[model samples]
Target chain A: QQQVKQSPQSLIVQKGGISIINCAYENTAFDYFPWYQQFPGKGPALLIAIRPDVSEKKEGRFTISFNKSAKQFSLHIMDSQPGDSATYFCAARVYTGTASKLTFGTGTRLQVTL
Target chain B: SAVISQKPSRDICQRGTSLTIQCQVDSQVTMMFWYRQQPGQSLTLIATANQGSEATYESGFVIDKFPISRPNLTFSTLTVSNMSPEDSSIYLCSVASGTNSYEQYFGPGTRLTVT
Candidate 1:
């Protein structure tokens, strides 16, 4: 069972445009939502995250819009640049016992053109 | 956040052969996890490497197939036994940074190709 679902398998946007990727979770127990950015051969890097208490969180050019009622969240990149082109993943984590378990969504490949 | 390094960034092994991948973290962590990502697929949890105890395997994973060793808090090893072509994928090791944080830091994955 895919606990988290992400859309737009691939995306292409202009350099100055906004790139948006959406995700939804099935498990309501998930309290932590994080987004990761991965390059071709490197590990995924932490971008920005949000909890259910807040509806949005922004860091630099990246923004995360979350909706607790819909169990959905999104990553938005403003003034997209070519350097921002990479695969993005939305992940949810619910506190299990001593260790937490993460549920990841299928990745979205984002391409920003000049 | 802990910095993790994985050994043998990539390897190609024959069918029925086994390869052991090692993960080393800069700091001690309570939990270490092994994940597998097939070509163009999302990451799937293989097992949780527990310190001073047997590792906990996920539903589709088994101890014999993906044996894990967590002798200490800062180091762990995952062995893919009896590898087949179907076992070809990128294996990643991750750990949460702080007790109150929700972020996970991953190492550059080990790419295993079984022929």
Candidate 2:
């Protein structure tokens, strides 16, 4: 089963416009929600992360709005740029003992056109 | 955050052969994970490697197929044995970092294409 589900397999936005990607989870045990940005041929890097205690967290132009009760979260990129064109994955971390594992969403491929 | 590097960014191997991908972290870590990302699929955990312990593999993965080695806290290697065309995927190594192990950092990944 896909524990985390992401919407809009691909998206396109004009430069200076806002880009949004959404994800929903089924597991309530998830506490840490993080967004990762991956460029072709490279690894996914942490873009922004939010704990369940916070409803929202923002880093630079990237923002993560999380709703614990709804089991949903979304990523908003303000003034999206061409460089922002990449694959974005939303992940939830479930801790077991001393280790934590991430369950990733299917990912959204965003393209920002100038 | 830790700086992670993987050797042989990509390789194409023949069927039935094997390839060993190495992961190196800049600092010591208690947990390291190996993941496989197939085309159009989410990253799946292959195994978790801890220093001085046998790797813990997730379901559908066997230690005999994907043997992991964590000889020390800063280094680990994953060997994909008896490769097949279905084994063509991107293999990534990640380390648990940050306070409370709240963050995980990933290596660049090794793209393996089994022909």
Candidate 3:
């Protein structure tokens, strides 16, 4: 049913510029939102995450802006670099009593070019 | 963060073959999961491997096709049985930082190709 929807299947931004990816989710049971970065031939790594209680969270150059009422969130990379070129996925977590499961977005492939 | 590793980093199999992938964690964890990523696609959760019990699979996934075994807290195995070309994908294993934490970590991944 595509609980989480992401926009811009692909993106290109110049190095040192800002790169942004947007995501919207439908399930309110999703209490945690996390962004994962993946490189080719590798596993997805957790980049940053935020809770529904927080409007924003920043980890170094990576920032996550969340809107509780809208059920939307976005990831912004300040000073995007060629090293940051990778696929980004937005995921929502819902606790199922004993464990948590994540529903992922389609993904956004970002390319930071010089 | 827990360090996770998967065996048989990649494999190529013929149709009707079965491939088993192993996942090992450095520390004990209560919750472990299996995920699949098709070519150029996002990750999809296959099931949750519970220690000492049968795995809990998500919708669209079943035990007969993707059987999972969590014999202990730090290890699990996923077997893709009677494979087909459509089964080609990268299988990944992940674990929560801890039961009380919200963070989850992933292993490198097992790339499988069925011809």
Q: True contacts preserved, each candidate?
A: 0.57, 0.55, 0.60
Give the candidate order by descending DockQ: 3, 1, 2
List the candidate 2 regions with Cα displacement exceeding 4 Å: B98-100
Model 1 chain A poorest ten-residue lDDT run: A94-103
Superposition TM-score, candidate 3 onto the true structure? 0.98
| Candidate 2 chain B worst ten-residue window by lDDT | B96-105
Docking class of predicted structure 3: medium
lDDT of 1 by residue, A34-103 (tens): 9989888877888899999999999999999999999899999999999999999899998766678888
Per-residue lDDT, model 3, residue B38, is 98
**Runs off by more than 4 Å, candidate 1:** B98-101
Model 1, residue B31: distance off in Å is 1.0
Which has the greatest lDDT? 3
Top DockQ prediction, candidate number:
3
Model 2, A93: alpha-carbon shift in Å?
Answer: 0.4
Better of 1 and 3 by lDDT: 3
A24 Cα displacement, candidate 2 (Å): 0.4
DockQ of each: 0.67, 0.64, 0.72
